[model samples]
Target: MPNHQLLNNMTHHDVKIITDYSTDYGDNISTVMTFPTEFGDIQKEYPIFFRKYPDSEEFQAVVMLGLFQNDNLFLQAGNWQANYIPGAITRGPFAIGFQDQSADGGSEKAPVVHIDMDHPRVNTEKGHPVFLEHGGNSPYLEHISNIFTHMMDGIEVGKTMFAAFKQFDLIEPIELEVTLEGDQVHKLHGNYTVSQTKLNELSAENLQALHRAGFLEAAYLVRSSLSNIQKLVNWQNQKMQQQVTSA
Candidate 1:
């Protein structure tokens, strides 16, 4: 169940409205809203995923929006974060990604974010899987729609959107053994591949290892992305303020 407090006070058009709802290709339920936007804004309302994942550590998701610099519309593919390469595996804007563990490789050695690397496919070969992996269902449409509706209220005008996605059930990895053309072999197991046995066992060393590996990086990424998003909001607010003052 989603936390309704997160969706309170959200509205579109300033009038009572009903929005179209749909889940992500992964079948993960999410709420979406499209609202009017100023000329330079990142288009209309916004979509927010409001699933409260049971496991805090395993899987997470987020929604971000704002007027980006460089005169570019940053969406699903081709965005700063997409190409940033958080170690390996390029990502695309607007799409959710997964980094899971391999069957043979223990969680520590190779924490892989699963996606078909660039090839002839959808949206500039951005490395997103063509179809939702077995277990990943597009979030429910109602979830997407409601979040979008609430986002307008939840998020201040002109701020880059950022939310940490989490739900063990929502993003469980589907095991698969894949072989590529060059006899290359690949396998997928579970996202958040880092073993949590230590956290469960309360092993100090394991907890330390999690912090050292990508755990800390994950925390930093969330924080940094949010910080940058705030800048976008500030920029939007400043512009609006200037317009108001001049008018």
Candidate 2:
């Protein structure tokens, strides 16, 4: 059975540190998040997978972005070349994913997050737009609006942007404006603070922003892993066919 610790940890805290390994991915928790059944007797395991990049060397630095459309979640994650443009924003990737659970878990329920897919530029350079390169499948257009497609499509060439959660330097604990929407709307979720003291702290005001950015990157990584695994499965089948034919 797949471990649920990581997912459990993710659910408990809005932000947590994670390390990825090819063979043994390390997450702080040991349980995955689960949803109760209608009978309230069983829980379903949520699927979790990491993104695989065409260039293995760039996986660590790159992020994956995703969006949901027609009940299927679409995703693409990548970064720009070092020499692409002048004064480019050294930003994290964009990612898209979906969660059915909501605060109320009833009518008027919405996904946990509402992606700003229509934004002209997010985390990237001022004029840059997010997009996937020519490959396996075209990205789902539901999350992003048509108004910005032209600008985004142009920047998407050779660049795949994923969602990200940015790391920040924290000096002191701060009050973060957390948007809590599911079951209850709490203007202030909790005391905003980071216990990691070894690092020089960023201003408290920037903590929430960093957390949001970092989350985006994390989502991208997850999406990339899923696609990478799918590709690997396909490659294996093809290789097996070729060998059989030769024999």
Candidate 3:
């Protein structure tokens, strides 16, 4: 239900985008789509996991933000508590679109920036402006462009990493059960993570290939991020205690 259009200074000269993090702006989510290229930074604050794409059978990496759907623990009083927000989450209301381009007597598609006019972040009078008064790209828009470029590159690297993971059977399903305050139980299922055992058993030639492709470090980053799951549990407990005290 998004009203997407090619971003142009002429048409959206006065538009501003909300850069603040809050649930009101749709930041309340349990996970955000992530990529292998970002696994190193993402692992520092979030637990990395894989889930099947809803429309496709392919697996995609995600940075878990909360234990339950629609619950983002990092959103505290309209601010993001983490040092690094996932690039996927930071690029709000903007996406890379392909447009036809004439080249060498033939037409090909080129990536372009598209903005969702209907998104909550889109406003005419508040937050960061997308264009300057002179109808040029604003500094915020330039930052978004860089983010989109990195996202595109990350997508390609992620494809290669996931393909290698599938080929080596290094993915394994994980089920997490947590007992919260008042003995409330929460269960998460159907998620996947890197299998260190399988990774260690890979042939030397395959290991070398992974190392050459830079997936070896990415695999370990994914493995290391699982430790943050306990951090998430601790956060939940603290939130629950605060709720009880306030009540």
The candidate that achieves the highest TM-score relative to the unseen native structure = 3
**What would the per-residue lDDT of candidate 1 be over residues 23-69, giving only the tens digit for each residue?**
22211212122211211122112211122247753222333333422
Best by lDDT: 3
lDDT of 3 at 189: 90
Better of 1 and 3 by TM-score: 3
Alpha-carbon error at 232 in model 3, in Å? 1.1
- lDDT tens digits, residue span 188-219, model 3: 99799999899989999999988887888989
Per-residue lDDT tens digits for candidate 2, residues 110-142, read: 222222333223223333223334321113222
Q: How many residue pairs clash in each candidate?
A: 39, 47, 0
Give the runs in model 2 whose Cα sits over 4 Å from its true position: 1-215
**Residue 65 lDDT (model 2):** 15
What are the Cα lDDT values of the candidates? 0.29, 0.26, 0.91
**Which parts of model 3 are misplaced by more than 4 Å?**
none
lDDT of 2: 0.26
